[model samples]
Target: MQAEAGNRSGLTLSVPMDLRQLRYFVAVAEELHFGRAAKRLSITQPPLSFNIRQLEASLGMELLRRTTREVALTEAGKVIYREALKLLALARDAEEQARRAANGEAGAVHIGFVGSSFLTRLASDIRGFAAARPEVEVVLYELSSYEQIDALQRGQIDIGIVHPRVMPSGIASRVMHREAFACLLPETHTLARQEAIDLQQLRHDDFVLFPRDFSPGYYDKILSLCLEAGFTPHIRHKVRNMLTIATLVSHEFGVSLVPASLGKVRLPNLVCRPIAHAANPSDLRGIWRQDEAQPAVLALLECLAASPA
Candidate 1:
């Protein structure tokens, strides 16, 4: 058996009045005169009267008691007038929200980034974006390249600033060449005095490097650079973050290779020197799901483009 709408929903609902009719009704109810309401609505009195009568007929009630001299709302009309005002306000709010979303001036963008990205201009660029776009919220998450990939594939984040490589197929990306490679060492290390050192020079040193599982391509790139220098490194520790590696190096745990940008960071006891053989590599790549190229994401990308890598 067919069920009544109110019974099915477990809540009584009034007639589904359209916004135009409700707007006309509210204007007349507030002004209490057909001539003033028509002027406010930029229409003539005849159509306004017709819509008010139609609304009354649909609801099966006398909304207004009128004569040639003045118009006044009946008791039932006063109640619906308040409710109609509320409904009209909600409709206007919905339209404004929709327009803002389409223009990319509202909504939120969730971003996932590796820790090392903060060492470059990209960090300041992001801060600039937040400042300029006050309406679009920016949600940030610190994650490894692996975690960023998982989040991207699962639709957990809107953008991922990754390292070493871009995400897999079906994802979009922008390569941002952020930094050149550098060797990290304790300030007292024998080779620390030189501003530039060849990769082969540190083949014998124990290495503190980012873990392979955290970023496989980056891990392999370091290894291949070592092989090109003609020796395998003696890895002393595998860590997840650049700061941790710097902390370990400061304690004289081992010599390490990191981005030259890291030298700009305040690691009290650590030092950085350019790797002679380490050519420029894009330290960060912005990745996101192709399907999720939303306005907020695009706005962020536009801001990212202005900052120097």
Candidate 2:
């Protein structure tokens, strides 16, 4: 719509030409016959002819030459016709991009996850979502449950796959996975042959546990469970990552309790046995901000909901 003066006809920035007019001109120019163009546009010839006349007046030039038996494009008409096609194509692309963005088919989503989530069905869910929405950019980060909560509140991540905790105000959550805590032991340990081991039976064994600072709430929950069983666990080693804790237990460093889902994996030198009469642990889940529900994030949440817990 910017101004370019005195080059061609009376066409100027102030003339206020519209897409409909450009479409009409292109149709007439391509067909080189007003009757055919009017039929194609699903309009009567009189109105089509009038619109063309108005277009030519605005441009201050004769765009089409009409004889009793034929019609043809003038030199000025040829130039404008080529540029009009490009403009119309760009306009269509602009509309399509806007629509795709609104529908959540194109954009980026940031997800933060705890390491333990990968051992469960969460990995498959992430893969499925990425495959289904190729246009959506998926960004991932590994963080602790506490770290994820901080990231969500500070607007650093859109969603968090984390351990259960007390959600702060303005946060939303859904339990995407749940599993009872199982006793992790060395494959060669005496308890490995048993279907289940009593929690009190391990009172003399050292424990590999997460540090209280990793998640004070979860740490306290584990302690409360052990205390209920009539004993205080002697923590021999503390680790931050769940996978490392499993590895440590596999190497015969100490005994530990873990999610039952981890028992699905047949790790070398490791055996997961249920703790008889043990209380259920808090569930692993997905969390996000309630006030800022972006479409891309919602689409990912749907994928998580459909995944096996």
Candidate 3:
């Protein structure tokens, strides 16, 4: 092989030196005895000596001072031995990382989720996934159901936690949890003190709700539930975040219909009550593109399936 002289170190190196030669050189350099080094490498002395000579020729330098009685490393041999150790270690690490990534035990996954999911078991599910797959990094993004659908289609997120509904083209969904709807009312509201309130009782009440564009399916579902009781809500304000809707209701600006699990949000002056009439349950679903086959995404899906949410 042709060798190139390095400008900085005045060392010549073959363009592609065989790693086996370097290994043999390191063995002999450390042992300082050809017989002992060959035994350590499970080889005979002749082949070991040949490999060391080849390595020295490839680097265009004398790597060893050999005598009938003993062997010792030259200055060039010491430098090459230290560098070979590092190269071998790096090669081993690279192979291990590749294997772990192929098996879905390492790498990063970008996840999108609607805000309300945080109030449910989603947090615990994520925590469990992180604990089980310490090498796999989880990146979180808070997005609306509609936003998640678009992000999934664009390949911006690997997975999404959203309210279950008809998914857009190329996307598939798995239901994670089913939750009932509840009314969020101001503490000073007349019906707030009641154990449970009928949806019809709030017929004339002004409503605070999430913006229709953010999640049209969920927004319309809430409206339909109100209509089933008596009257269509008088929408006074629309916000993009569920928690903010609760904050608005706390100030008595209006009431909102949110997933029952959001009742866990303990805002002062805010109260949540179950609707007396039977209502459609809200579904939390995990969504991904039908064509997605990323190992990280698959591992996260497995985690979600194993955990209750």
Candidate 4:
């Protein structure tokens, strides 16, 4: 590329100019005095003068008209000065953008989550994050806890909101919210009218639950809670989706023990009642790979920490 003067002084300056030389030229052009420009640039006047001479030689044009009395810019010098200012400004902007991305203040984060987490304050938390870091884009994926674990392991997602029984190897997690289990029962069921029902009361009822493989830790916790209530549940229906379980219960398929968040579904024929004797609360955790170093991921974690569910 070349910068050519419009008038037929016929000057065409090639674009192999160094940024440092351009900076020096701009300082001199703006100051109109080599000594003052060198002072402003915190450099010795002799080196500045040599660099300017070299820049003029490379451009094959005399950019400055200099005398003992004063300094002035030639037409080509004036044009070059304006272009140099733009180039320097662009370079500074690029540097600042890179730094912001490195600091986690700007970029993109892929977030994986289970659908039930939305029942808590996950939506509000996401909004808060967006408001806090408007430059960082957040993309969300809805996956089961197990799928999230797999995605995290494969580096497909930056972070996950999951219900993990045990922290997987090389993955780190923190519980963001803890919720007690609730019973989703058909409105016509005997215990549906109770504000809170003991699990023992539903021993004879067929249970609709998430498949054990979906989240063994949570599934086992539900079974243990039932055992503590004095009877083993008769699991007759298995599901993978929390909302589907509620839909099934609404149809009188069976009762289900699910995180209290499912109460928000509020299906027509289903009522979610608290478990009277359940002591363990299902944990919703924020998980990430231990080796993650992305600035956007760190920024998201910070946002998650500031907003409590």
Which 10-residue span in candidate 4 carries the lowest summed lDDT? 1-10
Number of clashes recorded per candidate: 0, 0, 0, 0
Q: What is the TM-score of each candidate against the true structure?
A: 0.84, 0.87, 0.83, 0.87
User: Would you list the C-alpha lDDT of every candidate in the order shown?
Assistant: 0.82, 0.84, 0.85, 0.87
As for TM-score, the candidate ahead, 3 or 4, is 4
Candidate 2: residue 128 Cα off by (Å): 0.8
For residue 189, model 2's alpha carbon misses the true position, in angstroms, by 1.8
- Model 1, range 1-309, lDDT digits (tens) per residue? 111123222554467686788899999998999999999999999999999999899777798999988888887787778778777777889899888878777889899999888888888888887887788898999998888888989888888888866457988887764677788999989999997888898878999997777787778778888898999989879999888999999999998878788888677778888888676453688887887758888878777865666
lDDT by residue for model 4 over 99-192, one digit each (tens)? Answer: 9899887988899998888888876887778778789898899998888888999988999998867876999988887888888999999988
Q: Pairing residues by index, what is the TM-score of model 1?
A: 0.84
Clash list (residue pairs), candidate 2: none
RMSD of 2: 3.2
Model 2 C-alpha lDDT versus the unseen true structure: 0.84
Pick by lDDT: which candidate is best?
A: 4
lDDT tens digits by residue: candidate 3, 1-309: 222333337765545667788788888888899898999999999999898888787677788998888898877777777777877777789889999888887998999999998888778888777787799999999988888888988889999998766887789898887788999999999999999989889988999987777777788889889878878999999898888999999999999999999899999999999988756888789999898888878988887877764
Which stretches of model 1 miss by more than 4 angstroms? 1-13, 131-137, 227-231
